[model samples]
Target: MPAEWEPHEGTWLSWPRREGISFPGRYDAVPALWRAMVTTLATGEHVYVNVGDEAQEAEVRAVLFGHEAVARTALDASAATSLATTVRGDRVSLHDRVSLHRIPTDEPWCRDHGPTFLVRDGELTLIDWRYNAWGGKYPPYDRDDAVPSRIAELLGVRAFHPGIVLEGGAIDVNGRGTVLTTESCLLNPNRNPSLGRAEIEAYLREYLNAPHVVWLGAGIAGDDTDGHVDDLTRFVAPRTVVTAVEADPADVNYGPLRENLHRLRAAHDQDGRSLEVVELPMPGAVEWEGQRLPASYANFYVGNEAVLVPTFAHDNDAVALDVLRRCFPGRRAVGIDATALVWGLGAFHCATQQQPLAVHT
Candidate 1:
């Protein structure tokens, strides 16, 4: 599978429905954030969205048109610098670098339910791991489970189904043969009680073609997906990774994050080289209605020319961006305000999937 940091042709997103189960009371604000994200992503690479039908596509186009106008208005010389961080540094025209596909979806967490793209010898393929709504926390995920097949049909590529439940958010990989994941999510009985760690690793090796699997411990507090590595750790390079570390000993995430750090420190890449691990700061707890949400700087999405980071309104937002900037020297790490977006328990990385740019002869 192509690493998240690799150049992409486009990013795939499932537009949220007004009646979807993802955002209960925050639905009204969700689409606006999506538009902002789309605007930023469209300038660098194509933004593929799944709209259910003609009306939904029209609604999405209207939103895109309005945002495009905002982007166009910012074409002034002084506005260029500011919009570079907010959306894009260039103008956004209607139907520009975006393709609307009519596909039904139940939720907007595309990373959890989207097709995991793979490439080999200038050809692209997809792997459709089973999706059970993060081990059945939410029911009636039929539409989500079928998304990979629908995407494969649209792309005209062969898709393989491993028949074991896994979410794209659960694993992060280097373009090489190293894959990072957590035991808490994959080994959860609700998803695949029948398989053991070795068995699951074997599947990951075979499907992702990444023989090196680095297993971390649990996830942060309030993460519905038991322990998604994206919320705890992610690969920043072929032999390097940045993991979330909580300083406060009394915090719930401290012990688990430290344990994962220890594991990463001792981990090695496919070539048997020790990994260079970087520690990223964790933001202060973000809660909504008395419930702590899964807010982490590690949940950053790498696009073609930019890395979209989920930044909470915290001091660490700047720190995370700076650290990621150093890790990804070639790509700019753009932070998005995820304070309101995380009300759905995910951030920018969770809402999108990348399609690698196909190599041409």
Candidate 2:
């Protein structure tokens, strides 16, 4: 698996459906966030969106291509900047950069169900990890599970079936040989009861080309996927990671996050070098109707020219952005208001999957 900061041919997004179970009530308000992502991502690389049908494709087009009108009405101030000025105040052409595929999905969490791309020996391949809808927390994921094969067919790339339950969001790689994941998510019997830790690690080694695996303890509170590492920690460099930390000792996330940080510091990369850990502040707590949503700055998606970060309306929004900017010094770190997006239980990283650029020999 290529690192997210690596060049990308495009980013994959499984367009959300109005009737989908992700956003129960805030479906209407979700398109604005999609527009923000499409426009900002289009500025750096092509965006391949998976739509169920023509109508869904057309709706996505309106929100992305009609930036002039939508920017004035639908987009707020921050999103307006994404649509109008991205690099050097230049307007991005979403019409040229965004392409809609007819591939359908059961839900919008592409990071979990979308294709995981691998570039090795100048060849790009796709991995079709069995998706049981996060341990069957959500059912009828047939469409989502088929996304990798469909995308492989579309891209004319070879698809490899790992024959195990693994979400793309369950692991993070440094484009080297090191992988980051949580034992809570990967070891849960709900996911792959038949496979043990060593067996799962072997799968990661064979498929992702990651020989070293760093296992974290657990995820934050209200994380429905047991404990996905993407919300808890992320690889910023080959030997460096930025983990989410909760300062309040009384908070439910404090202990778990602190433990993960300690593990990262003692962890080693593929070269047996000690890892450098950076602390990324959590956006306090974002709740909707007494339900705490999984909102973490670690969910930022790295683009070719920008990093789309999930920012709750908190004072730490600036702090997170600054931290990400420093981590990805060459890219613009743009924080989109995820107050409404996280109500669906995920943010940008959860909604996107990066397709790394392949260079043929």
Candidate 3:
């Protein structure tokens, strides 16, 4: 698997269904967020979206083309600026860069259900890991589980089934042989009870082409995915990881994040070099309807020319953007307000999956 920052032929997203469980009562507010995400990403690389049916595809077309009026409830003023260049007349015409496929999914969290693109012998291969909807927390995930194979068939590529349950969001790779994940999600009896740590590691090494595995402890507070590492840490470089840290000792996330920080500082890359750990501040606690949602700056998505960092309108939004800008100096770091999107317990990274640029050998 290639690092997210690597050149990508495109990005994939499963459009949120109005009846999907992710956004619940806020489903009306999610499409605008997806539009903003797609528009920003299409400016850099091709964006492929999956819709459940022809009707859903038509709905997505309207949303992207301005045939329908999007309620800008989720995006803040900055998103307006980000959407400016991509717009034409009343429509955001990314006709050349955006394509919608009739790949149905039960939910819109594609990173957890979408294809994990891998390059093998200079060709693109996808891994179809068994998905149990965060360990059976969500039922009727049969459709989401079949997404990888669906996409493989569509693209005419070889698909590999690890046969074990693993969400794309659970792991992050450095593209140079190192993978980062958390023990909480992978080791929890919920995900893979039949496999031990060693067995899981073996699968990751064999499938992801990552020989080094750096394991973190727990996830942040209120993350429904049993602490997905994408919400805790991400690899911004071959040997450098930008992790989220909570400054308030009283906050529930402080201890676990601190422990993860310690582990990253001690972790080494496949080349046996100590990792360069950069600390990114947490966006405090994001709540909706009296329930806390997992919101972290670490959930930013790296595109060909832009880093879409999720912001919660918090003061630290600028700080997180600055930290990431420094980390990815060559890429533009744009903060898209995720206050409404985080209600679904995810941000940019959870909804988007990268399709690495094929290197024909």
Candidate 4:
């Protein structure tokens, strides 16, 4: 098995275009948020984005460049920048720091569709986990499913096929020998009903190269993709996890989430050391069109210098940010307004995938 990938040199994101998948009347916000995210990321590292064609590329450039804040203004106001920029024909540079690609793809969730890059013995490999559009919840995912292989080919890396129904958001690694996941997502009948827990563990061991798997029970309420572990628990450090907690027993997630918390506290890591579990308060439930979206604080994506956390403009947003700040020392933990983004049922982590740098032995 290959070694786990390290932090990515940059992130890959798909520009949102499908109205049905993104939610009605909110398609405009998708591009805005995508641009904003890319701009913020470009300040630290490169950003590779996929667009449909010349037309779409033009749209992306207009959204990004048109809003490129003057360096001085950006440093002071931070709010003058628009997420999208003006199209410099087919290619546009965001302050000479970011690069955009116009690759055509059907879905925008690159974290699930993009290649899972890993390194072993100083060699780069790609783990192409089968994606089924979140258990076939969205149909016609042919383009999305093919993204991993395309990325692998583009990168000229060896692509390994893990013939199992796995989404990147379903698992979290500690960069050690331990992984954290929830049974509700990985064990669901839709994903791999024939595979027992032991069999699944074997698959994880073979692909992720992890010796230990810590199982948390379920995710918080409003998670459509069963219980994606990324929306509930994350391994902030080796042998340490930060889980979302709900204190009010009246809330729907209070019981199941608490049970998961208990399980995490009782678990141990690969070294047989008890896990240090931290609690992050769940943001007040967010409902749109009477449907609760999976607005979670656990879905923050870890970057080189910062952890991009999704905040729902709720009271708990500050507390969650603070908790993550404590958890990630030396890394800025900043919250991105996710009130509009969650309408698509995912956040920063789901929207981006890390292509870990090849490790030299």
Cα error of candidate 2 at position 39, Å: 0.3
Which model is ahead, 1 or 4, in terms of TM-score? Answer: 1
TM-score of each: 0.93, 0.96, 0.96, 0.90
TM-score of predicted structure 2:
0.96
Comparing 2 and 4 by lDDT, which wins? 2
Q: Please provide, for model 3 over 1-361, each residue's C-alpha lDDT reduced to its tens digit, 9 standing for 90 to 100.
A: 9899999999999999988888888887788889888887887899999998988988898888854333345444655655563465434357778999989999999999998999999999999999999999989999999999999999999999889999988999999999999999999999889999999999999998888899999999889999999999999999889999999999999999999999998889999999999999998988887888899999999999888889888999889989999999998887778887888888999999999999861
Candidate 4 residues 153-256, lDDT tens each?
Answer: 77788889979988888888876778888888899888887998999999888887888999988777778778888889888877678898988899889998
lDDT of 1 by residue, 242-279 (tens): 99999999988899999999998898999999999999
Instruction: Please list the residue runs of candidate 1 whose C-alpha ends up more than 4 Å from where it truly belongs after superposition.
Output: 67-94
lDDT of 1 at 36: 61
Cα lDDT tens digits, model 2, 125-197, are: 8899999999998889999989999999999999899889999889999999999999999999999999899
Off by over 4 Å in 4: 1-6, 18-20, 70-96, 359-361
What ranges in model 2 sit over 4 Å off?
A: 67-79, 85-92
lDDT-best of 1 and 2: 2
Give the clashing pairs for model 1.
none
Q: Which pairs in model 3 have colliding backbones?
A: none
Cα displacement (angstroms), candidate 1, residue 216, comes to 0.5
**Reference-based lDDT, each prediction:** 0.84, 0.88, 0.89, 0.76
Question: How far in Å is the alpha carbon of 174 misplaced in model 3?
Answer: 0.3
User: Which is better, 3 or 4, measured by lDDT?
Assistant: 3
